[model samples]
Target: MGNWSMFTWCFCFAVTLIILIVELGGLQARFPLSWRNFPITYACYAALFCLSASIIYPTTYVQFLSHGRSRDHAIAATTFSCIACLAYATEVAWTRARPGEITGYMATVPGLLKVLETFVACVIFAFISNPYLYQHQPALEWCVAVYSICFILAAVAILLNLGDCTNMLPIPFPSFLSGLALLSVLFYATALVIWPLYQFNEKYGGQPRRSMDVSCSNRHTYYVCAWDRRLAVAILTAINLLAYVADLVYSARLVFVRV
Candidate 1:
């Protein structure tokens, strides 16, 4: 089952990548393709869009649908975070490219499929970025709001000079949100992997395991500190900044190489 899950994930990732490249006009330049062929492209992309929607959005739905404590909610939040990363990575092609012209590197679609994906992706992000968003939590609210501000700034950057608008990176709103979400996923997952926790016996207390009856399998393990989540958020904040720089460097290379 593990092997099959990995295979399925790779398959989906490859399919999404192909759709992105096709939308970038990469294939057409080699084989003489055009927007005229978009019907077929759109159909394939839309199908994939539905598949993505089904897989990723469900985590968010489950996250917000009901409230639960214990390590379960932590697991759900982590799952949502992971899915967000995958969604954002797949979306980078569309986000990194500029929305211009009908075809070529400037063409910013893979169509409405992108728009639909973006909207759903955003909804998921709005919630995960602040799981307490509906609860009037100020700190988390501020964190999520910062993302919104960054997104608006990115959209503004695209509208202005736009740095050749064709050769430079055009970070739009969806792209902005997706980029941070992706980086956040990395940090959160890494922390979760390293987090140390041991089950305890309610009858005899905390820390040391009194009996073999209380195994790691019986109850979920949680991080020793809530501060781990804070640490993950901080690391991702650095990652988000680095990602923009990387995008610039990558765009510059593509222009020079004419790839």
Candidate 2:
């Protein structure tokens, strides 16, 4: 599961580069999914993916290598990954909606926040994929379910907007977006509270002693422990909760102010 997160960024980077090249070459129409929303959505996600990789890879693996070609290669990869993260971030900011400009929903504030919400959920997924992180407790498993369900809903919202299918919904799209954002805020808040309490509270059979554990610092140990992953998930849940709150505010403003 540790290597899985690393692989994800590699795959995302490759696909994103292909998409960018296709759009730049004016061959975007060759693919059915290459609509206006696709590029922005991909860029936003790619930026976060690379940012996570640049931080995680070095922290997890770089210290294990000695002063040799392998360490140098790892450092070089980290540097390039950071540069890629910046490139993707610049692309998102460049394409974001400007004042009085008519653009797709993906270019708007709520839309960009959707990208952040989904990316944080992705990192949460990676952290929780190790069964030892949540398998012992049903409540912990429920937290995982919360993450998955919210991720699916947010992804669906993005796809519907990208496909211009929001018009097919029975409700006004703004109201729909606001409703989903509010629902996400509620769900994520529950996870934010539940995950930390269940993971760190001794009353809940939680660790409550991860700070005193020194096994992770051993040179031979490269993978993060269950305690570390649990803490990571807790922090990420809180982050996504705040993102949903911001998204909800923007969406609500779109409903009322635009009216």
Candidate with best lDDT: 2
In every candidate, how many clashes are there? 0, 0
Q: Write the per-residue lDDT of candidate 1 for residues 1-259, one digit (tens) a residue.
A: 2232334446556755776787686574554334333333333344344455444444434344445563465455446545645555455454433533344332333222223323333443533553532234343445555545544444333333222242344555335434543443444333332221211223322223323332323432321132333344444444444444444444444344432
Q: Give model 1 RMSD, 1 decimal.
A: 14.0
- lDDT tens digits by residue: candidate 2, 1-259: 2374468567886887788788689886777673778888888888887888888778777766789998998888888889989998999999999878888899888999998988889878877877877888898888888999999999999989877788899999999999999889888888888888888888997777776455455534456766777888888888899899999999999889953
Worst 10 residues of 1 by lDDT: 192-201
Which residue pairs of candidate 1 clash? none
Candidate with maximal TM-score: 2
Q: In order, what lDDT does every prediction score? A: 0.40, 0.83
Model 2 per-residue lDDT at 230: 80
List candidate 2 segments past 4 Å from native: 1-13, 211-220
Off by over 4 Å in 1: 1-130, 133-139, 149-226, 245-259
TM-score of each candidate? 0.29, 0.88
In model 2, the worst 10-residue window by lDDT is 212-221
